[model samples]
Target chain A: MTLASPLAALGRPVLAALAALGRVAIYAGQTFGALFSKPFYTREFLSSLLHVGWLSLPVVGLTAIFTGGALALQIYAGGQRFSAEAVVPQIVAIGMVRELGPVLVGLMIAARVTSSIAAEIATMKVTEQIDALVTLSTNPLKYLTLPRVLAGTLTVPLLVAVGDIIGIMGGFLVATGQLGFNKATYIQNTLDFLEGADVVSSLVKGAVFGFIATLIGCYHGMASGRGAMGVGGATKTAVAAASVLILAANFLLTSVMFGS
Target chain B: MIELANVTKSFGSNHVLRGVNLIVPKGQSMVVIGGSGTGKSVLLKCVLGLVRPDQGLITLDGQDVAKAEREAFLARFGMLFQGGALFDSLKVWENVAFRLLRGPLKRPKAEARAIAIEKLRRVGLVPETADLFPAELSGGMQKRVGLARAIAAEPEIIFFDEPTTGLDPIMAGVINDLIREIVSEMGATAITITHDMTSVRAIADRVAMLHGGVIRWTGPVKEMDVTSDPYVQQFIHGRATGPIAAVR
Candidate 1:
């Protein structure tokens, strides 16, 4: 192969990546534009809120409780090596609120909500339901994408707040009941250790992650090819992309808020 | 009248419609016939503005369809998709009255439901079917519901894409008869795209045969059987050997 040929091959992928990014950016702009227009689908929005927020509670609760218990155990074990065993309550509180709670909840939503949105929309496309909506004089962006994205963005922070409390409670239970600590003292220390910034950062991250997850789901779905393979591939890509973006956003937010 | 002049469309290197020209006059049922992948559906989609042409003009009542106000332009037309295209998340009545429940035709819930039930009854569905989701209905029932939805808004123009596909022959006959009755009773301009000759005989006022990216033959349905055109004969007769090849 010629030198120019290899160079062209490398440049082709970069160009394709840029084109995909541009398409997503344009889709996002159109979605936001539709938000201000008439024909807002109130019923769809309320249904989406139920799916993205209220319906997700049990899964979020279970994940948070289990994670918080395990985190306390690990911190206690690690602390004993440095004569820092007594610091378990404080570290667990900070870790759950500042990092694990938001990140885990974001990942779960990606797995659950993002995949679901992608699959449903892709199926609609394959069946020509989106075109049906157009023929009905209803914009698909307004009726389908906007409500779900808005619900995710507005409700995830609430879920994150709820998750943080449940996770702290899990840690508190483990510390007080199984680790030979006074229940009242553990509760007081945990509450005293967390700052307002930690909670704020957690919620902010939750909102951003939610936006990325739902937007990626809608984008990949609308762009899906044809047939069963198309639906499967879109769901896989949506979940993967949402999860990675959430993690990357978490790192950036963490550094911005706490880096020295 | 809806008119297409030199309409052409292509996807990548595969040219679908090339210099397609046809006129569907007001208040007539025009059936377009062609083999699979002959761009019959694409022609319908182009008129609906669901698919834009690579080149050419489509006009409705002498106004360019591409430039018409979107909602108002769409409001004048309704379509029944090949797969029924019913929204699975919606109940049957809600699917029928989709346009009435929202957008420019917004109606109160009770009024919309009443209209939906009326439309459903028009298509021979019981009132109880109105409350059931699309998935709960059989394929034939789904198609009837789709027909109800298409006529729900009382549009002046209606397009049916493969209206009888994926149904038992008896059910297909029922759907074909329903389409014929509805189009005539409404006095609406109707365009139907299908390869099924039975559907063509049962539905068309005029028949047009699409072949090799163009209109090969078009005339009154009564004259279709006697047409000397080879493509029209081969397609209508389901011949394996003709001017058109059987295999891609």
Candidate 2:
């Protein structure tokens, strides 16, 4: 078969990209409009809380414990090169409270919750359940998206707080047991080094990340194309979008909180 | 009453509903029949305001339904979806009493559950079935539960999208009879979209055939068998040699 010229070869990709971008724009508009609409799904919202909040605690807690332990060891090792080993306690405390805990939990939620939400909603849309909702005098967005979004916004900050404490505790365990640091001294140093600003910043990051994760999931799921293939594509897109947006927002939040 | 005038819906280059116009009188059952991908579901969705038509007017009782108050218009109707569409998280009673337990019609849970059980019983379901989830029900039972939910609020209009698509012949017949009985007893205008001719015979007072994104033939079900419309004849007969092409 003869190959197409370079100009012709570029056309398909360009058109595909534009089409994708157009779909994203439409999804954003639909979600934004739905956000303000009335007859919100209160039952769906409460149910989403059970899904996004209560169901997520164990994983978030486990992740925090391991991450905090690893982080303490890494900080101690790096601090030793400059004879700054004693700084490990302070660094681990500040880092867990201000940065790693919320960011990691946000990323985890983006991976787990965002993908599930996207897949579930996309499947419903593909199967015409969304249409069924409309015909039943229900607004799909109000009945679907708002609840998920609200649950994320409310629960994620609480998750971040739990994760932060667990992470710090992990660091404490590692510092005292494995690193041979004095337990009381390590705890005292951690408490002395951390401030309200660090905790507040982490919680703020949690809220922002939660919003991003749910928004991406809702956006991709609502704009999902037809059939199983469409739902799979939506799940992939939602996870990717949530992950990228979480990281970017983490960076922006960190800078705004600490750069000053 | 519902009327669609010159309604058109297109997806990019694919025109799904092409200037389709039809009318359903008040408190009557109308079945729209067509093969898959022929825009039968799309037409129902347009009338339900799920899909916005590119051009035309949809009116209910002389009021412009397409531009009507969304909530007010939607509250007037109920829909039984193709796959039942019950929420998996809710028990059978919760699903049936969905409207009664929430929003504008919020009732006490006990009261709603009682009504739900009553409605479930009306659909030939046992009271014990109310405690089960949608996932626990068989396909036929799930359809019955959906029918119960549709009639729970005694809607003025009801839309049934493929109400018998996945059921056995016996179950399908049961559902068709239930739909017919419910619509007539409640004096509700009913619109059903299906490819099943048996369903059309059992549930529809009038039959409209959709082909190539438009209404090909629309008249009383009594007239459908005798109509000279090639599309309807080929469709109802399941023939491959007429204007309709066989699936490759």
Candidate 3:
């Protein structure tokens, strides 16, 4: 192909991507705009809390423990080269509280929560249920989206807090049992080394990532194109968009939280 | 009464509605007959505010539909979607009494259930059917349930989108008869979009033929076949050779 043709092909996709981003921004704005409106569906909000928060704990907990255990081992081995092996307890505590805990939980929520929300909404659209909602005098954004996004934003910080504690416990288990560190001393070291700012930043990251993951899911699902192919495409795009946005938000949040 | 004055809509370059104008008088059963993809569904959606028209005004009584308060306006009408569109998460009774159990029309659960069962009975469904989910029912049963839901609130207006689709001939006839009887019984203004000639004769007082994104001919159902308009005649007779092309 000629250079001009290649450049045009690249330009086309970039323009398409920019247009999609603009659409997503509008969808997100509409979703948030509905938040302060009257006739709030409290029943729907409680239901969303159970689905997006309570049902998600098992997967998040499992991922956290495994990650914490593996992180402790890696840190222990890597620090041995510098004859800094004893720093394992402090390093694992700081790492779990400040970074790995929230990031992993956010990713897991992106995988489990985002994909499901997108598929359900997209299927509803394909089946004309959204139109049915309109005909029923219920706003789809209020009835379907706002509750889930609110639930995600509110509960995920708690999930991250739980994840951080579980991860630190996992690290403590490995360090005390496998690494032959004193159990009491390891716990003491962890408590002493972790700062209040670390935990605060971790929870803040959780809330931001939660909002990003859920809003993207809601946007993709509601804006899904027509038919079966469209629903499948929407579900795929929701997960992809949510996962990318979570990571990007994690970076920005980290920079703002500690970069200064 | 509902009036459409030069309403138009287009998606990208594909123009779906083009300056179409029609009126449905109060308490009249108006059937819109058209081939698939002729914007029959789009027209109904436009009036319901599900799709925004690109131009012109749609008014109910004397006020513009789009400018009216949304929930109050929607409360005056009910729609039977082409696919039934029942909330799969809800049981049959819950789906039927959806309005009664929520929003401004909230009622006691027991009362709502009783009303749902009563409405189900009106549509020839058993009270036990109210407890079952929509997925457990056959297509004909689902259609009947959808009908029951539409009439449950005693809406002043009802729109039926392909009410007879995907059913056997006998079931289709049953649904058509029920739609006609219910519309008259409630003294409700009704609009139905269908291509089924049987449905047209059974449900409509007047029939309007939609073709090429515009109303080709509109008159009493008796005059539909006898109209001099080639497009309406060709459509009613299902002719292979006519001014209306077989392909888009």
Question: Whose lDDT is greatest here?
Answer: 1
Q: What's the TM-score of every candidate structure?
A: 0.98, 0.93, 0.96
Q: What lDDT does each candidate get? A: 0.93, 0.89, 0.91
Docking class of 3: high
B150-234 per-residue lDDT for model 1 (tens digits): 9999999999999998899999999999999999999999999998889999999999999999999999999999999988998
Q: lDDT per residue, candidate 1, A1-260, as tens digits?
A: 69899999999999998898798789989988988988789999999999998988889899999988888888888988998878888988889888998999999999989999999999999999999999999899999999999999998888888888899889888888888878888888888888999889989988988888889999899888899999999999889988988999899999899986
Encode model 2's per-residue lDDT on B1-248: one tens digit a residue.
89999999999999999999999999999999999999987888888888889999999999998679877788888989888988776799998998887667778999999999999998999999999998899999999999999999889999999999989999999999999999999999999999999999999999999888889899999999999989899989888898888862
Ranking by lDDT: 1, 3, 2
Residue A166 CA displacement from its true place in model 2, Å: 1.3
DockQ metric, candidate 1 = 0.95
Q: Write the per-residue lDDT of candidate 2 for residues A140-249, one digit (tens) a residue.
A: 77888888988898899999999999999999899899999999899899999989888999899999888788878987898788888999999998999789889988
Cα displacement (Å) at residue B115, model 1: 1.2
Error of 3 at A205 (Å): 1.0
Model 3 residue A225 lDDT?
93
Off-target runs (Cα >4 Å) in candidate 3 are: A1-15
In the order shown, the chain A TM-scores of the predictions are: 0.95, 0.88, 0.96
